[model samples]
Target: MKLTDLDYARQLDREDPLRDFRQRFHIPTNAAGEPVLYLCGNSLGLQPRGVTDALQAELEKWARLGVDGHFAEPNPWYSYHEIFNEPMASVVGARPEEVVVMNSLTTNLHLLMVSFYRPTPQRYKILIEGGAFPSDLYAVQSQARVHGFEPDDAIVELFPRQGEKTLRQEDIEAAIAREGDALALVLFGGVNYYTGQLFDMGAITEAGHRVGALVGFDLAHAAGNVPLKLHQWGPDFAAWCSYKYLNSGPGGVAGVFVHERHLGRADIPRFEGWWGTDPSTRFEMGPRFQPQAGAGAWQLSNAPVLPMAALKASLELFCEAGMQALHQKSARLTGYLHELVTSIGAGAFEVITPAEPEARGCQLSILASGDGELLHQRLMEADVICDYRRPNVIRVAPTPLYNTFEEVWRFWKILEESVS
Candidate 1:
């Protein structure tokens, strides 16, 4: 059967092992009460049906136990964040002690930077990808400025070769070597937001370490979307938001992974807080701060029970489905989307994302010709919920958890019509 045939797409869906997982989420409906073609999991994931019950459980605990909920039965509020350590570690492929669910994405980045980005007068530059997500760029810029250096001088942005859509691994390695001993930190996004490029994080980490620089990644697009081995890759630190591929709600609790090598190191400077103190001694009311042994020490405040509850619901689904399985399904699903988009004739649009299945996750960033915004509006009117960047990029993620192959096929038809 032709790949463009609707029957072929439906057959793929029928044979999908992950097909049953789609029903776990609450898909949004159009005016006529049909589910919209939701391809925006790269921006915000569909709500898991389990989220309501999870939130209600916490609310009920608060109502019944009040402050005593801190130590109450089932999942206690005091140690709420502890439950995520192992599960989140599993998602990112790290040791349980190295992972902790904490503050928002950029907030976690800043906190981890406080410990990792120790800029000396000689080695003061932070290397990042060009056209990084605005939040990451801002965070690194501010970190450099805080250390008394101009942003332009202290930050080195890596761009692809002339006329290239995505960066090559060789180029990234060459850039790191060029920076050499002068580089203080190598901070990058695990997946480029604009191009949907999944960087070779393990290689990047290795290269940075060879140059005596600490490396880290903002896994906003990578987490849950791709299978990561953070421990084996051995980046100094990493952080990610649960809201996107993790399918946690908006403004959901974010997470951090501090390499076990950095755990309990007294030399590392971090902004300390009461909750970060040894939990056994946290209630001692002592002035001298004795930090917890692992990533938990980075916490500044007690867990936000409600937000964590919402995340916990989503994490359960991730845990059940498993990252390896999800990633395999993601590659196939996104590969289908890529095939459909590219088959729409070369002049209509360009797929800026890497073609290799291993080089990306679920997203395929289409650089539409002419008015991309008009095409985006047309997609919205057709009840397709993908996202558009300012210039010409349309990011469509056929998330493995809830999105369907049929939707991808229908989206291609709509995109072809809109472009013409």
Candidate 2:
């Protein structure tokens, strides 16, 4: 495991079970015409090789069949969304009936909140993580305001204990206990976008439910990077976008999960549309709205075929590789990145992400002690592509599907020279 061991790195790559997956993606090359070391999958995953053909087929269908393409084409636009159900369900650890592919991430978050965040006068408080993504904070705050409550009074943010970089299970449990009586909902990210901390979803859900609060998760950072069990964990709802680790292209169709227990609750309120109505009775033009049985009940419109087509292409690759195999490779690749970065001696840089493998996905956030941005710029100049968060924190993710162990080593070698 020595940092200088090139043979060791190559050996690891040779033994990688998912090594063949790298060829399936189109890695970007630098201006000098060399393939840049890509470690930014946590932001936007590299495109799959099959996406071009998947999209081309749709365009061909449009040209040939015109309006009749809805039911005449091979994949058939009328039922194209249905083709994604099984693969998506397997990815998120849910039954087919409990998941749906739909609108963008924030839109789905708003729709889920409309149903799950039913704050009563006595139980009107919401709990969220302190360093959540800004969009999530805004959405939750807006939901509280529309219900005639002050954001500060109704939303409780749980932060890490003093001197700690991440939230602890005991601290989270204590907060739920203190606010459980008044807490109507508990919503948090499955993985912290900044620090790359993967929260304990099952335990948190249990703690929230103990106090009669509904639990939900924003799985943007965790969806394809980690193994999840949304159905078994019994979260009331969860949402994620497909652009990042899912590699479906930017602004692709997102996904949502709802537990089967909520399917029969006709009284649960939601913002519905024609697509969510019962299919058989939908075209009848009935005055009364009867929602579909499961997660489809949350849909707001007809499926957008282009984004869904790209998503389907990426998902087929995921289905072939399998999540468990991908995660197994991911753990070692990220661990190697962590070890190399930390071995570069103190006063040069520090890693803010958790050391425990179980507590993170693929990302590793490093806080350079001085001139962090300068070091990041140097890495970019060397054609090692990783993202830098403002002020501090350089985020590098060795995604199992496309990144190689040698790429991880080279990124750190560049960092060592830049700091020196």
Candidate 3:
């Protein structure tokens, strides 16, 4: 019997060590009162059941103490962001001092660029993937314009070859070498949002340094979904949003990773605010700014306590389950989805994500052969929730945290019926 049968899916779910984790999240229900087959964690993860308690505790604190809650026990509002240092560091594979949970993804990206994208006449170009998320593209373009250089001339975008959807690692290394000393910085999405392809961050960082350029990554789609060793990879900096596979609520607090080598260096320029000041002299109202050591120095404002509360709930879950177990099950779960899609036995669509395990994460971007928009609408109507890009792709994410093997099988049925 084929493994795509319903019995096989049930067996897989029964044997899955992380099976109970699905109960921890509040899965959405359809009109008929059954839980929907939700595979949209790539866009926004399902809310954890603990989120309500987390937020409520903070709301009570604010009501009771008003302005004094910043010093309260269990979780002080003043040092709210500090609580995340160890857990966030573990999630991204960094030292506790190297990571900081702060502003949203794009905002953090712009802030990091201000300090790291130091363009000189000799090395003024920024290197990026051609099909990166639109927000990153806009940020990089504006950075060049702000530095008094034309966007077209100062930005180098590496694209795939003819009839190719995903970029090869060799091509990326070649581009970094071709740009050579002219490249000032290399900034890439650790996983391509459209194709769901995972770039070799280690190789990319090495190539950038070989050419005397700084390297960084926008891990919006990579973190929590894939195993990362940011400090070991030795990228100059990195940033990510928590809303997706991290299972944080919508618009949750984001985080950053700064290499230890840049610590205590006043040479790199950055935008400063009171929150980043040394805590010892922070309230002194001193004239000169003495920034905190490590990634804490990049913080620009007071912690947004409410959002951090929700993010904290999810990070707690991550620390407990551990990335090792999550990553191991993720590969198997995603592979099963890939198998089922290929056996659909009709040329209705194609999976554009790389086939190799190391070359992609949890998502599989399906390029519909025709009527892709209509197909997406029909899937939604059937209570199968995934996401669709503008033209052709339908991105389905089988998250290891809350998604199940049986759910993936159910989705395959829904997709097959809808397309047929």
User: On a 0 to 100 scale, what is the lDDT of residue 208 in model 3?
Assistant: 98
**Candidate 3: where are CA atoms >4 Å away?**
none
Q: In terms of lDDT, which candidate is stronger, 1 or 3?
A: 1
lDDT of 2 at 368: 84
lDDT against the true structure, per candidate, is 0.93, 0.90, 0.93
Q: Candidate 2: where are CA atoms >4 Å away?
A: 1-3
TM-score-wise, the better of 1 and 2 is 1
Candidate 2: give its CA RMSD in angstroms: 1.1
Q: Kindly report which residue pairs in candidate 1 clash with one another.
A: none
Candidates 1 and 2, the one with greater lDDT: 1
The most accurate candidate by lDDT is: 1
- For each candidate, what TM-score against the reference? 0.99, 0.98, 0.99
lDDT of each residue in 24-50, candidate 3, tens digit only: 999999877899989999999999888
Which lDDT tens digits does candidate 1 get at residues 1-420? 999999999999998888998889999999999999999999999899999999999999999989999999799999999999989999999999999999999999999999999999999999999999999999999999999999999999999989998999999999999999999999999999999999999999999999999999999998898989999999999999999999888998999999999999999999999999999988989988899999999999999999999889998989898888888888888899888888886797899999999898899999988889988999999999999997999999999889888988999999988887
